[model samples]
Target: MQLDRIDYALLDALRKNARLPNKTLAEKVGVAPSTALERVRRLRESGMIQGYHAEIDPQALGIGLQAMISVRLERHARTDVAAFDTYLKTLPEVLSFWHVAGGNDFLVHVAVRDSQRLRDFALDAFTTRKEVAHIETNLIFSFQRNARLPAPPRD
Candidate 1:
């Protein structure tokens, strides 16, 4: 959907903090509470706002280590890829996974309790899979997320 200045302003305010009260949000975007409510509803219905999420610290959940595992598959058939994707979804350690181009077919992000768990996770998750041709694991020291997205160019 084409977004006007009000839409962009509402998105910017929400992106920074989704918990902002409706009154505060309306104030920030220079709109009346009811208009802000209706506009946000429209945005959601249009799928502009997919969902809101809370950022949680991995360490707080007893996750001491996190790593990205690059996986190269031996086969590129649809069935093989789909099966692998389904398998990744079942893994509790997997934070997220991306199917992408390049040398690797997939990038799997995971979190575990310690280095041993990380090693075990890699071996069990990737090395055992027959379709997996190669796997590379990289430790993540720190992570950060951008507060807001760049504004989309106006038509």
Candidate 2:
């Protein structure tokens, strides 16, 4: 579905705050509340708008450190990759992971209590896994997110 200027405006407003009231959203997007509601519904149906979520502080949840680990797999077979992916998902420390095309098969982001826990997690999680050929971990001192997405491509 083609998105017009109004759609783009609505998307921008929603990205900054998904909890915005329908009336507030409509006002920001310069449309009637009913129109804004319908447009948002259409966006969801088209899969343009995914699910909304809250951004919680990891520190508050006892996460004192975060790390990004690069993993090289021993085997690149579909079964081996799938199994490792499944195991990663089961780990509560795992925030997210990317299966990428590069020197590493996967880049995993994890949150832990401290450096000790981070080391233990790496040894227990990746080092012990036979599928993992090699692994490297880097401490994350800070992180940031850009709320607004770039403008969509023109037809």
Candidate 3:
């Protein structure tokens, strides 16, 4: 969907804080509250804005360990790939999963309370899969930066 300056401004305000009130958004974008609402609705309809979620601190939640696992599958059959993807979704410790092109077919992000739990998850859960040929696990030390793109230039 094509977005004009007002639409872009509304998106920028929402990205900064999705909880911003419609009145505040309208004022910031120099539009009526109803117009801001309409643009936001259109953005949602077009799938440009997926959903809002709160960012939680894993350490505070007692999930101190963060691990990224690169999984290489034995076969690239469609059924086998689907099964593995479905299986990963059912795992509570798995935070995110990605299918990428490289030596590995999948990259899995996991968080656990400690090192032992992380090891158990890697061995008992991941390695046991018949479709999984090899696994490489790496510990994440810290997150440097996680930022969204800058807002489009206002005309």
Tens digits of per-residue lDDT, candidate 1, 59-132, equal 99999899999999999998889999999999999999999999999999999999999988889888999889
Estimated TM-score for each candidate: 0.95, 0.96, 0.89
Model 2, 122: alpha-carbon shift in Å?
Answer: 0.3
Q: What's model 2's lDDT at 54?
A: 95
> In candidate 3, residue 147 scores what lDDT?
45
lDDT at 68 for candidate 2? 99
Which residue pairs clash in candidate 3?
none
Model 1 / residue 77 / CA error / Å: 1.0
lDDT of 3 by residue, 1-155 (tens): 77787777787788778889999999999999999898899999999889987878989999999989999999999999999999999999999999888899999999999999988999999789999999999999986533454667555
Q: What lDDT would candidate 2 get against the real structure?
A: 0.95
- Go through the candidates in order and give each one's C-alpha lDDT: 0.93, 0.95, 0.89
Give per-residue CA lDDT, model 2, range 69-132, as digits (tens).
9999998999999999999999999999999999999999999999999999999999999999
lDDT of 3 at 43: 95
Q: Residue 23's C-alpha lDDT in candidate 3?
A: 91
Candidate 1 versus truth, CA RMSD in Å, comes to 1.1
Worst 10 residues of 1 by lDDT: 146-155
